[model samples]
Target: MAIEINRITQVNKAALRLPNQPFKRFGTLLVTRTETGWHHQEQLSDQTFEQTFPEENYQLSAIDAAGFALGAFEGSRCVALATFEYDFHFNRYLYLADLKVDPPFRRQGIAANLLNAAEPLAKAHHKRGLCTIAQGSNLGANRFYLAAGFHIGGLNTNDYRFTSQEGDTDIYYYRDF
Candidate 1:
């Protein structure tokens, strides 16, 4: 069956409840993994992927707990995800983080659609704007964000320096709504 994408609207207690039928029947599922202990272990296993952005612990407690999380599901599987948090450094702007699409679902426009869902939510919350940080080595992601209407703001060198991982840079991008 062809895949269909849907956005989750309500979030309660740091959990966004996704529609279950499409996920259950179509094999699309959204999984939220926020356990700091589990994330710490996962990061230790693969520092490269972990240090590409802020750690999951930071995401779970500092961001997800306070902002919005959106997922794109196909059938019962979560094919894409986007997380946003209020950034005080950017004058309380909403920042998008950890936008990811399952490898098998890349090039299907799932990620773009996920970001599309986040735009209005930021506006409704009266945020200054939306921003995202892309890993410097990830050319495709950088290009994708740029094509999706994000402008390059500046470089974030050693952004993940505290991470055990070595040699990575982050680039900041923003879009004014």
Candidate 2:
């Protein structure tokens, strides 16, 4: 497929039936959270996560609110996307709420390309930075965000548990432009 990353223009019926984006799940993110600090470990395995962006059922509303959305396309099909907005509460940072690419297209820089597309949009909106959250179970995503220059912003242990092999903590990451 000839991949093209472009701005989403129309959200018609055709756009609603996007292809499913799934990723192979490998390992689990082991986290130990205490009153004083946190510890993490990754135990590799062979598993998979299939996502059709079920949340995207509400994507039109998100598209309604977003500063913009970028679609990574294989021809006319949207195989990947990054959705975000400039909420005043983020101060100078744009809040990146969703970023996903189909498993078939992983490790090809599709998400990063979408993010690269987002930064200029954020800057054009007069924003200074960007921020996002990664679930503790998604160690690959955490590594991606870190390598992309994002750092831990904060954590909410109460939202998730520490004992389970799949952690429930929200790991916030921020990157300044």
Candidate 3:
């Protein structure tokens, strides 16, 4: 089915989920830190790791926060979702909070379209740039952000301490307009 991208409505917000298909491809992200510095790498794998979307009001809060919640719709069903909020911390940078595409729609360019669509929305809000945070263990996500020309803005190795998810790290990236 052809994909259509647009901002999601409040009613559709509850449908926010990790794709409908099984996540069958990923690479293990290797993270290490020492006094010398930090090292991160990805070990390619054919493993299919299923993904689960944790429930949160954050996506809906995007609209409430002077931002938008973009969705990639395949007809009436949403195939992907991307939401961002404006920030004054960096002269109105668009801080992306979520970007998820259903597994069945993988490799279909829906993600790219959604991201491209977000740029104009950010610009419309007079935002200076785009920024986002991702888990260090998510190698694919890290690669996508890096390949999109975003530079590492910050890193907090203990960012996930409260969640107590072991060595999970928070990686922040940003692109200047």
| Residue-level lDDT tens digits of model 2 in 43-144 | 775666643335456455567476666788887787887778788374888888778777778889888888887888889888888898877667788788
- In model 3, the runs with Cα more than 4 Å from the true position are 10-40, 43-51, 57-62
List candidate 1 stretches off by more than 4 Å. Answer: 1-64, 88-92, 160-167
Candidate 3 local lDDT, 1-177, one digit each (tens): 678887777777755553444343366555566776645678776665755546555546656576778888877888788877787365567888778787767777777688788898889888878888877767778888887777776677787776857767788778877
RMSD of each: 12.3, 4.1, 3.9
Q: C-alpha displacement of 127 in model 3, angstroms?
A: 1.1
Best by TM-score: 3
For each candidate, how many residue pairs have backbone atoms clashing (under 3 Å)?
11, 3, 2
Alpha-carbon local distance difference test for all models: 0.57, 0.72, 0.73
Q: Where does the lowest 10-residue lDDT sum fall in candidate 1?
A: 22-31
TM-score of each: 0.63, 0.76, 0.76
Kindly indicate the candidate among 1 and 2 with the higher lDDT: 2
